[model samples]
Target: MNILGLSCFYHDAAAVLLQDGDLVAAAEEERFSRVKHDHGFPKHAISYCLSEGGITAQDIDYVVFYEKPLLKFERILSSTLGTYPMSWGVFRESMITWFNDKLWIKGQILGELGIETEKLLFVEHHLSHAASTFFASPYKEAAILTVDGVGEWTTTTIGKATADWDGSGENKIDLLNEIRYPHSLGLLYSAFTAFLGFRVNNGEYKVMGMAPYGKPTRIEDVHKVIRVAADGSFDLDMDYFSFHRSTNRAFSSKFEQLFGEPRVHDSVFYTPTTHPNGDHPDWDRDVAAINQNYADIAASIQAVTEDTLLKMCENAYDTTGSNNLCLAGGVALNSVANGRIMRESSFDSVFVQPAPGDSGGALGAALYAHHVLLGNKRKFVQEHAYLGKQYTADEIKNTLDNAGIYYKHFDNDDVMAESMASDLNEGKVISVARGRFEWGPRALGNRSILADPRRDEMKEIVNTKIKFREPFRPFAPAILERFASDYYQLSDAEKLYPLRYMLAVYPTKDDKGSNIPAVTHFGGTGRVQTVRNEWNTLYHSVIEKFWEKTGVPVVLNTSFNLRGEPIVNTPSDAISTFSRSGIDSLYLGNYLIKK
Candidate 1:
């Protein structure tokens, strides 16, 4: 049976195809559309999945949506009503958007896919998040935690799941408890994200990146906005928040009073900690002092978020009594929080699938239908994140030739790996676009910009010259799985699924932080991606060759895209990025293009 799962009309719109319970293809619409965080109907993504699966929409037996639209509409309608006049703008906009399109999502899907009404199914949002993690996990049974911005009505859910790998038992996901809307940890953090001069959904990671530059001095002030209980259930002091009522603002004037003033968007962010030598280009003491306050706010929120997640994990462990935990939802993308959970929580192991946000919900919906709703035994484990579309060698070559680009072709993997390794050793930055693009926000090895991690200056070179991103944003250390523990404090490195997907942060060993300064953050932690040969042979071989040459088992890795753009999807996309950026070389399949 073929199932087509979809998540759309919200950020990170995506589509996934499953055949006989195994994921065939998955992709976010932004990849093809070139619109960062595209939230439209994922028709392009659906087309790609269908093409990759070698099947048309007619062949799909079922079409499942990630969430129930009616339930979400109900939440929006009721919340606006409860807040009344203060929410008039939100209510008016919501009515127009919902009545025009969102309320008719079922009809849209049916028409788009040419499927009958009976073939369409809808899963609850949080349930989709739960299934996305638990079903993809290798665990037979595990505790589940899904936390994100309000999903329909729920903001957080703690559950236990059981998978029937051998068909002896039934597949199940029982979400035991939930926290509802207007009192969400995700939104609370997002409020701080906006206050710190970052976009809500887009710039939350920037806040995470900025947090390490300052101490959590404003944590007490942050606590005034939200209160957490012993079991991790919490309520927001609504007077400080405007997200429930306003369309433009997430926090109220009172919140500004409590946290001082919000940071101006797009302003330079440099603190004394960032430039201990006082060498910043626009170094003004007053500006640096204000930026430090913003950084402190970022740190305070990050600390509270990590602590809350820890408490929630503890509660999930106590309630479910499971040694394993599966995490999904946008908040699950917080590598710092994930690292804390792994170290401080009661669970012995944690599994987070490659795409843990709304994009993953598409895969979750398909998995939920195939495994639980249809009573099928589990057969698929997401061992790697190479589930997206991949271009053949001829396709890559044709694109290069068409673009009049000079290139070299190598048939042997070892020769190409050695050549790339030599480039890194020469301090040349290379953008690699080989095999399938990753399913989630992380680049992994398939679509990554790689550099030598030994030089601290490579951080500035890659950030300012190649990526044109924030200087403070840390690069991931893509290390060979066996050497992960040698650099970062990850024990049994091969067994941790989050490490495979770059979903967990761990501190560099006390003696190893200085060895790879480019990838190590201000906090001394690295969001590590452990590469095994079986999962990505060429990527692993390149890192191994670099290790042989430099005596370091890691490479500085960032997504193969410019700032504000989705990661490159096609050969043309890769070439365009390479042509526009300061990347020294481009690797497309067996072909290499030099600047």
Candidate 2:
């Protein structure tokens, strides 16, 4: 059976194709369209999935959408009506969007793909998130938790899933409880994200990364905005937030009074007045103080989020009586909180789907339709994230030749890995665009910028010289799976799956981690990716070769794109990014290019 799943008209639009309960191809629209967080119908992504699966729209047996339009519209209408005169502007704007696009999603699907109305179906938003993690996980039974911004009036859900064999195996998911809209943990975080001079949704990670640098002294003030019960249920003080009543701002005037004036969007981020070497001549004392204040706010919100999520996880454990947990939703992308939950929560094992955001909703929708709705047995588990498109060596060479780029070609995989490893050892930043691109926000190994993690300066060099982003944001370490336990303090290393996807942080051993300062953050923790040979042999071999030369067994890895761009998709996209960025070498398939 060919199942086509779609998530669009919201951020991170994507398409997924499932053949016989196995995910064949999945990709986000932004990669193909080169538009960050594209919210239109994922025509390009849908086309790519169909082409990748070698099937047409006519061949698809079922078409499932990520969420229900009617229910979501109801939530929007009711919230606006509840706010009354204050929400008039938001109501008008929302109605325009709903009438033009959201309300007609079913018809739009039919018109776009020529599919019959009967073949199209819709799943609840949080259920899509739940199914995405539970079904894709390697667990027969687990406690499920899904948290995100408002999804059809529900913001958070705790459920239990069990695989039962009744002649055929089927995974059954029952939502035990939920937290409703306008009182969401996600929107609260986003409000702070916007208030901290960052874009909502886009800059939440920036807040997480910036937290380690400051103290959480303002957490008491943040308590006024959100109230959490012992059971982990929480409610937001609507008076301080304007998301339900306005489109212009997320936080109200009272919020500014609670915290000081909001940071301007164009202002500079934190920079220390005195460098480690000596006093910097051009350092501004006032700007430094402002940046420190912003950092404190970031830390405070991060602490509150972690505490709230911990309470939720504990409640899920208490309600379900299960040790295994499956976590999904955009908020699950917060690695710092995830690490805390892993260590501090009652659950022993946690499974987080790589694309926990809306993009993964496409995959979840198809999996739910196939395994849950159609009564199919649970058989497939997502072992790796290389589900996107891959180009052959000839195809890559064609792009390089057409672009008139100076390059060298190698026939052997070992030689290519060794060559790239050598360049990395020399402290040269190399961008690799080989094999299929990653399915989620993180660029694992295939499409990644690699550097020597042993050097402390490599982090700043990559951030400023290559990525051209914030200097404080830390890079992740891609370590061989065999050596992960040697470096990280993995309590349950045998069963942990979050590290495979870089979904959680782990404290590094003082003895081993001190040798690699680039990937280690200020708090002695790192978002580590444990790479197995079975997952991506070439990429693993590169790290293995680097280890053989340097004895570090790790390399610094970041997404293979400049700031404000999605990871490279096609070979031509790789060439374009390589040409403009400070990347020293480009390794495309078996060919290599030196700038």
Candidate 3:
């Protein structure tokens, strides 16, 4: 049976196809459309899934959407009523847009695909988040926890999953309990993201990365704004926030006054006079101290999120007695937190689906509908993330020829990897576009700019020379999976599914980190991508090539995109990215473009 799952009308819109309980393909709309964080309907992605699954719309046995639109709309309207005149403007603006497009999600999707509306089923937002985590995880039975911005009514939920022989061998996600919205870790981060002169939803990672640089000298101020209860639960100080009050946000004028400033826009960093680096010295010890403080605050946030979440996980574990734990949701994207919980949590093992964010919601919603809702017992386990499209030499050559572009093909894959690895060893920056696109926010090795971590200037060269982004931000290293435990304290790596994306950081294990000046962060941590040989052979081969040349066994890898752009998708996209940016050379498929 063919099942189609969708998540749209929100950021990171996507679709996933499943056949007989196995996920066939998943793609984010932003990648296909080249729009960063595109929230529109994922028509391109849906079409790609349908085509890749080799089935027309009618062949799809079920259509599952990530969230219940009507329920979410009800939440929006009720919140508006609760705030009354204070939030009326936000209500008006939000309602207009919903009426204009978002509210008709089922109609829009069915109309676009020419499918019957009756085939569609709406899953609760956070339940979809939970299912996406549990079902895709390696664990057949595990405790589940999910946290994200308000979805329908749930902001955070804890559940349990068990393999049921209930007449047939099938797994079911059973709910335990939840923490609802108006109070959320994601919202807290987003609020601070707005406070820090960054875009709220998109820029939260910037805040996480930037926090390592700023002192939480403002922690007391944050406390005054966000009250913590004795029960280990918390509530927003309400007076300091405006998001619930007006489209403006939940913060108040009085809140900003205590915090010392309002958020800064991205454009301000572009201007000569207000350039971010020019304003602050590259490495102020105070800034370094601040960065450390933010890491601790990140520590605190992770601590609290885990503390509250464990309450649910332990409950699920005790009830199910499952030795494994499965995690998903936007919060599951927190690698640092995941690492900590792995060390401290009660579960014997854990599995995190690589695309744990909303992008993976498409996969989860579809799998839930296929196996659980449809009563199909076929069990499908995902082994890797190389499920996207791949191209051959002829296809790539044709694309280049159609574009009237210049290129050269390599005689052997090893020679290309060796030559590029040699250049990296000598400190030359090279952009790699060798394999199929990765599924999530990370580039993996396929669409990444690589550099030598030992070269003091390599990070700056890749950032300023190629990416054209903030100088303070650090890049991740794609390390061989075999070498990860020796470098990082990933003792439970067996429990966690492989993470090709640089989503999380692990402290160096000598158990201490080395003086790899470029890749290691100020906090003595590095975001490492563990690449196995089976999943991405060529990309892993290139890393092995770098190791042979430099003996470091690691290469600095950042996403292959100009600032404010999505990762390159097609061959044309790769070429345009190469020509437009300061990338010295780009290895596209079997060919290389050297400038």
Candidate 4:
């Protein structure tokens, strides 16, 4: 049976297609629309998934939404009532938006596809997150944790899964327990994201990047202001935060008064000359220090989160005594903290969805419907991330032709690889848009801008020469998996988290002066993406080509986009980004374009 998964009416609206429990394709709507964090109806993404899967809307047996509408409505209604007159304006605005857009979401689905409402099903927010992990995982039964900005009523949950396939033995799922909302790790992080100069939902990463630069000098003040309960549970002082009622967040006037002053995003990233020491620090070194500091905060908060999760896991493990663990939610995306949980926590093995954020919720909801609700089970494994629409040679050629672009097509893969490798050796930046688009946030070389990492100035070249974004932000190294451990101390190889997609940062051999100095970040860590040949032949072959040409097995790989945009999802998006950026060449499928 074919299942259609959807996460809509929310930021990063996305769609995923699953056939007999195996994911066929998944995509975020922002890539197609060119609207970063586009949260409207995912018509473009849905169509792409359907076309890629070679199925129509009518062919889908299950249509599942990521979150439960009723549960969320209840949370808003209750919270508004609890606040009463003090929250009338907030309540009115929220209710109006819900009434105008969200309440009729099912109708929107129907209107978009002409499907019956009966065919549509709703999964609770956190459950969808859990399913994304467990369903995609190799483990049969494992501890589960889901944390994100309030999803319906659940902000975080810890649970377990068991044999849950259907009577036909085609599909299956099972769960244990959950934690309700008004408390969220993601919310706390987002609150801090706002407190910093970055945008709330989108710029939490900037805060993560920036944290590695400053001394956690404000830690004592923060600890006092943000009180931790006896059980390791903490609550933000409501007076400092405004997310529930107003969008301004914790960085209000009172917040500025508390702190010396809010650092403006555009201005402050450069000027704070003296760190807590007498040393001269560039962005990476300074940021590295800050990363260590943030890692401590992340480690501290994550310690509490893991402690709660461990208790929850132990309860579930005792009942099931299962050796596996699965996780979802935005918090699942925290890889540094995840490394700690994996090393120190309760589970023998763990599984986290690569797209553990809300985008994966769509896949979870659909899989849950097919396996749990429909009573069918089929063992599935997503060994690779090439589960999105791919352009054929002709399609790519046609796009380039229509655009009046300069181009070249190689006679053989070997020649193409060598030439591209030569370009990189000469420090030429190339935009690669080959094969299918990636399902998650990572570019994974398919939609990546490849560069040489040996040259120290290449990072600046990528920033000023191509991306034109913040100069300090470093690029990731797409290294061959065989060399992952040689380069990074990525714990266990067999069950290693897929660094192939560039999630977590690992310390280099020389923290300050690593081999790939260009890709290594301010914090002396590289967010590495390990590539095995079997997963993506074209990308791997090109990397091999570069290696053969330059004797360097790694290339500086960042998402094939400039600042403030989603990764290119189509040939059109690829071309547009290529035209805008200072990339030296473009590789769209078999077609290559040159300046």
In terms of lDDT, the best-performing candidate is: 1
Candidate 2, superposed: residue stretches over 4 Å from native: 165-170, 271-282, 491-494
TM-score of each: 0.99, 0.98, 0.91, 0.89
Off by over 4 Å in 1: none
The window of 10 residues in a row where model 1 has the poorest summed lDDT is 488-497
RMSD of 3: 3.6
Model 3 over residues 1-595: C-alpha lDDT tens digits?
8888898887689888888778888888998899998878888988888888898888987889998888888988898889889888988998999999988887887888788877888787777877786777655567777777778877776677765434545667876766666777677767766766667667766655655544344555666755655433456777777888677564678876775455445522221211335344454554444344444444344445545555555665676677787777777776666756666667777777777778888888887776678766645666667666656788889988888877778999888888788878777888887666778788788888888887767777877778888766777877888777777767645445644556567777753356466777656678888887887888788889887877777888888999999988888888899998887788889888888
Clashes of 1: 0
RMSD of each: 0.8, 1.5, 3.6, 3.8
Worst 10-residue lDDT window for candidate 3 reads: 267-276
* Residue 566 miss distance in model 1 (angstroms): 0.6
Which candidate, 1 or 2, has the higher TM-score? Answer: 1
Report lDDT (CA) for all predictions: 0.93, 0.90, 0.73, 0.73
Question: Candidate 2: which pairs clash?
Answer: none
Please provide, for model 1 over 1-595, each residue's C-alpha lDDT reduced to its tens digit, 9 standing for 90 to 100.
9999999887689999999888989999999999999989999999999998889989999999999999999999999999999899999999999999899999999998898999999999999999999999998999999999978999999999998999687799999999999899999989988899889999999999999998999888888998988888888999999999988899999998898889998678899999998899999998999999899889999999998889899999999999999999999999999988988899999999789999999999999999989999998999999988899988988888887888999989999999999999999999899999999999998889999999999999999999998888899999999999898876899788899999989999999999999999996899999999999999999999999999999999999999999999999999999999999999899898998
lDDT of 4: 0.73
Candidate 3 residue-wise lDDT at 569:
84
